[model samples]
Every structure is written in structure tokens, then in C-alpha cells.
Target: MPHKLSEIISWPEQREKAKTYFDSYGWPDNRNEAWKYTSLAHLKEGKFTASSDSAPIDSAQVIDSAAQLEGFYVEISGSAVQLPPQDALPNGISITDITADDNARAAAFTHLADNHLLPALSAMHQTSAIAIDIEKTDSAAPLPAVILNLTGSNKEGACYPFVIVRVHKGAEARIAEIHSSHAGLSCPLMVYEVADDAKLQHIRLQAEASYTTHLGLNQMQMGKNSQINSFAISMGGALSRLETHSLFLGSDAELAQSAIYLGRDRQHHDITSFVAHEIRDCASRQLIRGVLDDKARGVFQGKVRVAPDAQKTDGQQMSRALLLSRDAEADAKPELEIFADDVVCSHGATVGELDENLMFYLKSRGIAEEDARNMLIDAFLVDTLDEIEDPDFAAFMTSQINRWSLARR
Candidate 1:
């Protein structure tokens, strides 16, 4: 396991800019309004040990489930990228390690957020990056999903990995990213680009060890007539934050973002989003659900901005949390900034304990007390899962939720 930063790095300009920005802000704290609800005071003295491509990993287990789903797969252990054979991958799909290509790295960086603190932190520590490209257009047949399994050593250090995904004009793609490791910290930065008339289905699974701190940044840009549906599950890590910044470049695009976060045993989870809808006739929706128990804390913060030119835009946001224990806490903030008069926009949040009436109803139907509690919990989370259009993807998320519930029992 390497614990030292690489002497030679790629994309120097981006790294220098990130370093400069991070130095100004340092480790994010409550003072930063964005980091108000979630604190990083515990990691103030922490240092990032960039993972190397020479690091060893168990190749067999990382992406077996993804492969079973007949999906294309990529595995990143440390900085080592294991790609499927070109011959095995479906047509119109390609994966490349772009660390050596300055132009490619610059192009990818241009499509992502530069001022955000998390991305700056991620950019400063990364020595390499990868990109996945989809080229098919006007196809009647559906494309195979792409899955990325990112893992790090079970050591007391951090790993920084950056990835870019591109869906070309009129193309459609489904992507799943999984983080499963025991490293003290994992920071994965991702940027997605959807061209005109393109579509993207993005799913994220953060299941790192309970001792790990997973901080991630995801930025996306959509062109005219494009659409993106995104879902995320956070059931691991001692402290985790998933922040997203989505920008609309043209009119007639849509975005649907939803997530479910589960925490217990002093864990802390934060899910944040900032969406910019500056084009007309576009729409954006946000839905977040959280379950907290045993002194755990969950936070959701989402903001939407509609410009004056963004007429006929529809934006909606809702965040709800169910606390299973009195010690647990939930915090939610949903905001909408609209300069457009003809747009429909709304935001709401609700945090509460499980319904005793519902529990009693299930118990009266001959269900055990513990079983009835579980039932209500599942029912509360099912609505989030129901929004998913793919049955297989929904089932995969259900398994993770069930595992979390089982552990609580």
C-alpha cells in the first residue's frame, strides 16, 4: 500500500488551480454554509495518500454481480484500471484511461465544476483519471449498462479517483458506480455529459466499510432535448457526503434525481444537490428519503435556480426522513430561486418518527412487533424505489436496503 503522493502527476494546471482553491478554504467546516450541517472537523489533520496503479486487488469479487447482469464493467483498485477486452465490450461503447492525455483531461475538466470545494479537493489529490464514452446514435435496440467498481485497500489512508462519462448526441446509456472498500477515506469525483437528444441513467451505490469516510462529487451537464435519471444509495461509511451539481445547457431537457440514505451507530450521511435550469421548457425533480437509528445523523440540502429566460420550467423537490430512535437526528433544507414568472417550482421537507398507528395496524394483522416495524420502514422507502424505471436496478437497490435493515435488527 502506497501512502505517499506521486512525485509526477498528470493535468498539472487543473491540479494547481485545485490546490490554490483548496488552500483558501482548507478542510471544509461548518463555517462554509454548504458544509453547515455536516462537519469535517475530525479529518482536519488528515492527509491524502494517492493510490497507485501498481496496487494489488482481488479481481474476482469486485464486479461479479455487475457482470452477472450482462453489463460492461470497469474496476479501479487504487489507480489501477482494469477494463474489459475491447472485443468483449458492446459496439459504440469505449473506456479509456485519459491520465496521459492532457487534452482529454482538460476537456473532461471543462465539463465539470471548478469552484466547488469537494471537486477541488478531489482534483488536488488525483494523479490519474478515466473516461467512458458512448457513441451509438439513432439505435432502436437498447444498450447494455456500464458498471464501475471502485475499491481501495483496507488501510488507514485515502484514495482519490476521477472519472468522466460521455453520452454522445442522440445516444443513450445506463451507468452504475459502486464503492466497496475499507480505506479510511474515499473521494471519487465524476463528471457526466449528455449531448443533444441523449439520455442517461445513473445509479450510485456507496457501501464502503463503517470506518471509512466517503466524500464524493458528481457534476452533470445536459444539452437540448436531453434527459437524465439518477438514483443513489448510501448505507455505509462512518461519515459520507454526496454532492451533485447539474447544469442545463439548452431547452427541453429534464432531470430526475432521487436518493435514499441509511445511517446507524453514530454514522453521519449528507446528500446535497444544486441544480441550474437556465433554459426554457426544462424540468427538474428531486426526491430524497432517509432512515436513521441509534444516534445516527442524516442531512439533505437541495437548491434549484431558474433564470429569467427559463420560462415554463417545472421544478419540484421533496425530502423526508424517518427516525427509528430518539437519539437519531435529521436535517433537511430545500430551496428554489426562480427569476422566471411562468415557471412552476416548489420545495418541501419533512422529518418524523415512524407512525405508531401504522405499526399498530400491522401488529393487529398478526405480525410480530419487530416484523411490523420493518414492514413500515420498507413501505416508507418503497416509494423512492418505485420511481426507478428499471426492475433489475430497483431490485439491486432493494437488496442494499434490506441488508441495512437486517443489521439494525
Candidate 2:
């Protein structure tokens, strides 16, 4: 097999740094706050080698095999990406593995690296970094759409992939990023920037094979007066974890986040988030839900920070989980660190099984016991999907949920 990324122009300089970072730190143990629920012993013990450069992937084949998505499409494999020209860009915007060569891209890249784990991802992987620039407009046109496709074959070893996005000022866009791999352990990192007065709606989906091991990081920056609404769904992979961190740099900015996880068999899923309110009049909300069956495990950790001067800040968070089997496990930790006395902040977490009364009610309506149970689970999760502001985006999220539910049933 080919041994190194052929497209990376700066590989020789970054190789030593990559090895140093991975070896300097131990693979996460159970004691780490971010990794308390999910363990990486299996990934670390398997003795998997880093991925060797593989052949180019077929974009059409990936799209055809994927669940249908309504938006512009781009695929990222290794450090290679294919994008349409700016003028020819579709009303629904989309691009793959892009870089920051100018000021606009730099703003987003720096924001992501400073606040999140993008620096580690950048130094380790040979994947592409994508930057999206949205133009500002007064009237709400149909939300421009963007989709990112992640694909790789790890039959030989493990691989690390990274992608980046930047939303320009006064622009509006909606994006969906999907991660898929066939034969190896894949760790992908993504970072985003929302400029001043801009609006961004984002959706993330993880549907990899059962043998796949996955790690993901999503970091975002919300500029002054900008709005960011985001959601994520996790259904496949032996182990999948997502980390999100967002900071409000401008006053009057709003940030909303929601996620759903369904894990069966021995699958493990983890979602960790941190939202920082730094300026006055900033507001944020987070709601997360999960369903676990068989021997599956689900994890959620949400933390909110309010600066001393961030008066009038409104922050609320909740996490609810359903455990369907005796062996299943759900762990949630919602934390709040505040320095401002004038702010309003609250957080709560819950773990429970289906309501027997609701199940009995559905059965009384002549619904089969199994169908009634499935219906209740669906109802519980719809709230997270309802947060999507655009109707078209909502439909896509609904389809993803339904697809996972049917498979579990």
C-alpha cells in the first residue's frame, strides 16, 4: 500500500509533530471527564497502525449509497476535495476540503483552533480543511444548503481526517456533514466560524460500519450579532464520540444546540459540549436525548460558562435518556460555571425508561406492544428535531431519525 498522503505539500515538516502529539498523551482512560462514559482501551489495545494512502474514491458511488440529502454535495477523501467555482456556486452552498489562504479563512481557522481541538487534528491527519463564505442578505431566501462526504478504506490501518468551515458576514446557510468509512478506524475533526451578523444552521450525522471506530470534534465561533443553530444524530459505529465548543464574541448573539443518539448491541456513543457566554445580552440553549438497548451505552456532558460582565445572559440546558434494557447504560453531567450574578442560567439531566402508562394507553388503542413502544420512542425524540428553523432541514432530520428507529426495531 502507498505509505503517505500524496497530496500534502507540507508533510515532511508536520510528520514529527504528529507522532509527538499522539505519543506524548496516553489514550484516554476512564477517569477523564470528557471520556468517563466511553473507553478507548479497545482502540488503543488493538495495535492499529496509521492509515496508508489509498486510491481515489468515487463521489457518485458514495452519494448513491448514502441516505438522500437535499443540498449541494461535496466529498472529502484524504487531503483531496472537489468544489464548484464561486460564481457557479449553487443557491444551496457546498464545498469540500478547503483551506484558509486569505483573511476571511484565517478568521474562522484561528477561532476554531483557539477554542477547540482542531490544532491536534490539523497536526495529525492528511485530510482537507474546508472553508465556507456566506454572503449577507436582508430577506430570508431558501436556506442555502451544504453537504460534506467523508469516505475511506482502513483495511490496512487507522486514519485521521479533518474538515473546516467558515460562514461569512451577513450570509445565511444550512449545512449537513456525514461521516462514512468501510474498513478502518477513522478519527475526523471539523471546525466552523460564524461571522458578525450572519446566520448558520448545521446538521451532523454519523453512520459508519459496525467494525469502525470513530472520534469527532466540532468547534464553532459565533461573531457579534450572529446566530447559530445546530443539531447532530449518531446511529452507527462500534464507538463514536462528538465534542462541541462554541464562544460568543459579539453581543446579542444566539446559539442553540440539540442531539439524538441511538445505540444497539455493544455500540457506544458520547456527546460533550461547552458553550461560553462572554458578552452582554447573549443567549444559548441546549437539549440532548438518547435511546440505548441491548448492551449499548450513551453519554452526555454539557457545560455553560458566563463571564462576569455578561449580564442579562440567558442560558438553559437539559439532557434526557431512555434505557431500554437492563444491561444498557446512560450517563449525563450538566454543569454551569458562572461569574455573573445578574445572569439567568439553569441545567438539568434525566435518565429513565419508557412510561408504562403511556405504553398501556397506546396498547389500549389496539396498537401492538412492540409498535406502541416504538411510537413512544419516536415521540420522545421529535422535540429535538423540531428545533430546526427551516422546514426542509427538519424533513431531512426526521428521515434520519426514522431510518435509525426502524433498524433498531
TM-score of each: 0.91, 0.86
lDDT of 1 by residue, 1-409 (tens): 0011123334677778788887887887888888999888767857432221112223243345445555877888767888888888778899998867777776677755655677677767774588999987456878888888888875677778888999999899889988886677888889899999999988898877667778888888899999999999987777888988888888999999899998887888999888888789999988999999888899999989888999999999999999999999999988788899999998899999988899889888999998898888888987788777766677777776776676678
Model 2: how far residue 107 lies from native, Å: 6.1
Q: Give the range of the ten consecutive residues with the poorest summed lDDT in model 1.
A: 49-58
* Model 2 lDDT tens row, 99-126: 4343323333444433122345455554
lDDT of each: 0.81, 0.72
Clash-forming residue pairs, model 2: 98-129, 98-130, 136-170, 224-250
CA-only RMSD, every prediction: 5.8, 6.3
Local error of candidate 2 at residue 350 (angstroms): 0.7
Q: By TM-score, who's the top model here?
A: 1
* Candidate 1 C-alpha RMSD relative to the actual structure: 5.8
Candidate 2 residue runs with Cα over 4 Å from true position: 1-21, 46-67, 85-87, 90-109, 113-118, 137-140
